[model samples]
Target: MPTSDVVVVMVPFVAQGHLNQLLHLSRLISTYNIPIHFISTTTHCRQARDRLHGWHAHDNFIKFHPLHDPDFTSPNPEPNTTTQFPTHLQPSFNSSLHLRHPVADIIRSLAKTSRRVVVVHDSIMSYVVQDVKFIQNAETYIFRALSVFYILCFNLIRLGKELPFTLEMKLRLPDATATVSQEFTEFLKLQYSHQTFHVGNIYDSSRVIEGKFLEYVEKDEIMGKRHWAVGPFNPVEISPDVSSSAQQDRHACLKWLDKQPEKSVIYVSFGTTTTFLECQIRELALGLEKSEQRFLWVLRDADKGDVFKKDTVRRLELPEGFECRIEGRGLVVREWAPQPEILGHFSVGGFMSHCGWNSCMEAMTGGVAIIAWPGHSDQPHNACLLVDVLGVGLLMREWACRDELVTSVMVETMVRKLMGAGEGVEIRKRATELGGELRRSLGEGGGGRKELDSLISYITR
Candidate 1:
């Protein structure tokens, strides 16, 4: 059990990837008998609960605080737009600033009852908790939802240090500046400036795969801050029985995987924020059909500018007769699919991903190789880590040429190469080996476990 005088509050960015990371961390922290308050918009708070996996025994230790954003409006996406990034989410990001006052009020109220209120907030959400420094009984820490490799590279670039690898300077940097609207850019600026005060840093990363990068982040004079890499934050175990019936229903793909051969299926998902053009979607569908490989694809609409409103008219339609032709060879899940469960299954051999840090961590934990097709932001950097640094995946497309449409032929070729016998065999072996190391790191007395313990102790003290 932890000290009664201490309580921890979590503030995560509203995106699915960001929200999920902090929620997982909250669950881990709750295991130490520490109470956690997870705060976010009402929609996101509901998302966190609905998507939560594994055991529910620790639910009492964690609480959800949902704040309403009245000015927010979900805008319909322009499916024909040339931009590759999820620019449609700008409204949602801008509206999050409205939460500052309410979030601060909640923190102030909590501080009155607790001797120490430790605020762990997303790096992009620092502005929401800007008032923490003035609260006599409270302190704040920054939680980086990205991988250590990407974080190290970003800091190096910010400090004007030469990059470790040869790549376009623009591709390595955070692409939000180039892709987002001016209003969103200003919002980012506010967040950057407000992060001036924080007690320490926390990362959703681990020493096993990113040891050198983690060291660089900790040693660099300008970037160095007391930090912990207690990650692969998602549960490492595969516990099907722990899921509720509704969750089980959502994960019907697992039943299909059970019937497939060992390491024979590839799981494909671009995450919640990636928007695809109809033509591109068609090409991808045709490509999967041509690859002739067993696959499980999660086909969901991109997030709207205002997430609360549904854009029923502008749906992403698959190529006509595509599903019919690939009937037994593929499974298309139109709703939310249990990602961790799918990745951990025995039949899942690889993942075709956007290389978002959360997806990267889950893939690593599952020991699955990647077929990297990064869109924007830190995704390209993450793809580089998986393909070049880790040697456990293959890059299907580079970010420099992301503007061009990837044809059905190219997708087919790359998919076949990753699922077939030569280079794919080597990558899969390395992925499996690395996955073992990552899982072990979360075990008793391991590096991740120790770092988490140290973090818990620091907060309580």
Candidate 2:
């Protein structure tokens, strides 16, 4: 059979996290030899181009097209590259606001020669609602990069008086324990019954849940049959050189971690896009300091200059000498770090995270527990899944003051509890078991592998 001529256009907002997901999907599509067109702002395209400079050697199988979106440019002077991206700008969202025009143009261009055009798009750009009819003769499929569970929640919110009158709309309600309304929950069940495909979590299938949650998901056709979960799809190699200049000093964080005892180091990162007000950053620093445990932190543009001028920004402040006191005991990365490899490292015992899906999945694969501080959006939801449902993480409430930052005393206490203190050993054991299952699911003929095959078949045929 002739190869299906399809144009898979990914109009990703610029942030590294969004790019990672878009690129992973692109790579999978490319492997099937489907024509893929990836869209980004000029700045983002340049970033991707720089990373690919040495990697692909001019391979044209995947093409990058930059849209002329003004939002792509950062107005502030570039802050010195640091541990995480400055919060002032989120490039990943640049194209989303004005996505329809360019996307429709691309589809129209492709229609001149291609028989069918299937556009797999990120859910955030659901604004495609307006342009969906404009893209001539193309079948559009929405791609939700989040776990199936989260997608189900989103769909529930989108529902109208559907049956079982979901838990969100129910008369009788569960206590403070259940965040989602019973009416909404029932609506989700009804949606599942109606045969809509919800993505199944590949990592969860291999994990060992505390109260047979895995068994429940396995038997429920709504979750088991429809949704596809392929996660932590970081395209960067596990080991990228730590230095840009040959002579610049490179921190030997992994080497130091090698000497530490197993499960001793806590990895702390707020992801590439979250920017805390200066006070919060300082409190976090002080909390880590008080914790006294060996730690690895990524501190990007901490002074808040990345978001706006420090003087102009009212809430910004980093604790004085916070790094000096914790210097040797911690390895602080200023820019980007190879996260997946670091998470998989033996020295990483636990994670202090912002609860992003990619980080959550990586932690799950590493079998490391988490101390979650959800900054925004779906992070809070992800945190709930980790702490309440999975039993693999501790929920850290939002703290504005130093006293509440889970000081060294609290850190030590929590670590002790998670390590084997209060039913800690069992949680650790379950996490390890889940990690093993995730590895297998990504391996030959595993659930993840099979799902990718099915997704490809759906798109290609």
Candidate 3:
């Protein structure tokens, strides 16, 4: 067992992807018997706990410290906006800054009892832990909740390093025009500046897929801060009881998957933050109907300004009779669905996704082939990795075409190409092979395991 004298504190950004990554990492660290205090807003802490699985038995080792931000406002959805990014989330992002003082206080209190207080904060959440440097026994590490490929490319571009890759293919750095608000832009700048204080970096990536990119991160003078690639932070195996009774009851889609043929269903989801216009939703529905493939689709509105607010009776609607037309062949879930469980299902062969990093890691680790429909931010880079570098996915549409309404015919063609037997057969084979490698990396002798062990030793020693 690792030393109990060392306590780790986790601070994550409020986004679902960022929170989930840190929560999983906390679970992994708890296995070493290191106490972890996870700091977040009360709502976000609830969000993490609700979604947490595979580590229920280790709950004692992890303590959730919910900070109340009285001034924070919930996001109100703007239905007519053409922006592909989740600009509605700006309020929540801004509210997260209010956590700085309370988070610092928690760190100071933990530092009093522990010989070492190692803080693992999200890359975007550096402001919350900036005061840790003054706490003599405390040190911070920036935990990148993104692919190494995206991080290294973003860092290289920031340093004006000429690369073989084009700007469109890389993860773009935040700029004044890039964000919806000036406050958000300044918050992003603060996040970038605080990185210099971190003692090291930790990435939710694996050497199996990003070996070369990991090397690039290590050699970069500005970013080479003793990093560790201990990821696919999510569990490798799907737990039978991943969700609570209520969630399982809501997820009838899983029960539906069990009845399908092996490698036949195409799991379709755009993640929590993506919201589509009625026209786009209609086009997507038409394409799925025309493709004549078995599919499970998670349909939900883009997050509201306030995530915890009661759902409005107004919900995004599909074309009339769309569900009836594809009755047995398609399942459209309006509530939250267990993505990792669905992707890990034997019946799920391909994923039609928005190519979020968390979704990419889940799909890659599950060995499910991807139909990439990238939206904005790091998604385009993640799509590039999945479709170009990994050769385990096919691109449906690019971010450049996001404003243009993708016709039903175009969607039908991409769906057919990914689910059909021609090129998809090769893609599936590669995905399966890659999934095996990723899962192995989480096992005894794998690179992820080695790096995780190294991280524990580095902190506990």
Better of 1 and 2 by lDDT: 1
Put down candidate 1 lDDT per residue, 1-461, tens digits, no spaces. Answer: 23358889999998888888999999899999888999988888887777766545248889999888547656765656666566777778877888889999999999888899999999989988999999999999999988887777766655667665557544544543454456566777788898787988999998898888777777774444788889988999966674577556645788889889999998999987787888888999999998999999998877664445653636568988888999888999887778988999999999999888989999999999999998767788788889888999998876668888889999889888888999999999999999999999889988899999999999988
Show the lowest summed lDDT stretch of 10 residues, model 2: 168-177
lDDT of each: 0.83, 0.57, 0.83
Candidates sorted by lDDT, best first: 1, 3, 2
Kindly report which residue stretches of model 1 are placed more than 4 angstroms away from their true locations once superposed.
1-3, 55-58, 166-183, 242-250, 305-308, 311-313
lDDT of 2 at 47: 58
Runs of candidate 2 with Cα error greater than 4 angstroms are: 1-4, 47-59, 71-95, 128-137, 160-226, 235-261, 301-321, 398-412, 419-422
lDDT of 2 by residue, 1-461 (tens): 35347666665544555566666667756767777887766666665554331134144668888777454444432333322234345332433456567767776777667776666655545453245455565665555555544444444444531222245423221111143334434433532342322222332222222224333334444334444445435432244456666214333666667677887788888775565545456666676777677889877642221222344433334577777888877777765565676787788878888887778877887788888776544566677677766778876753222123344455556655664455766777767777777667666787766767776776566
Worst 10 residues of 3 by lDDT: 171-180
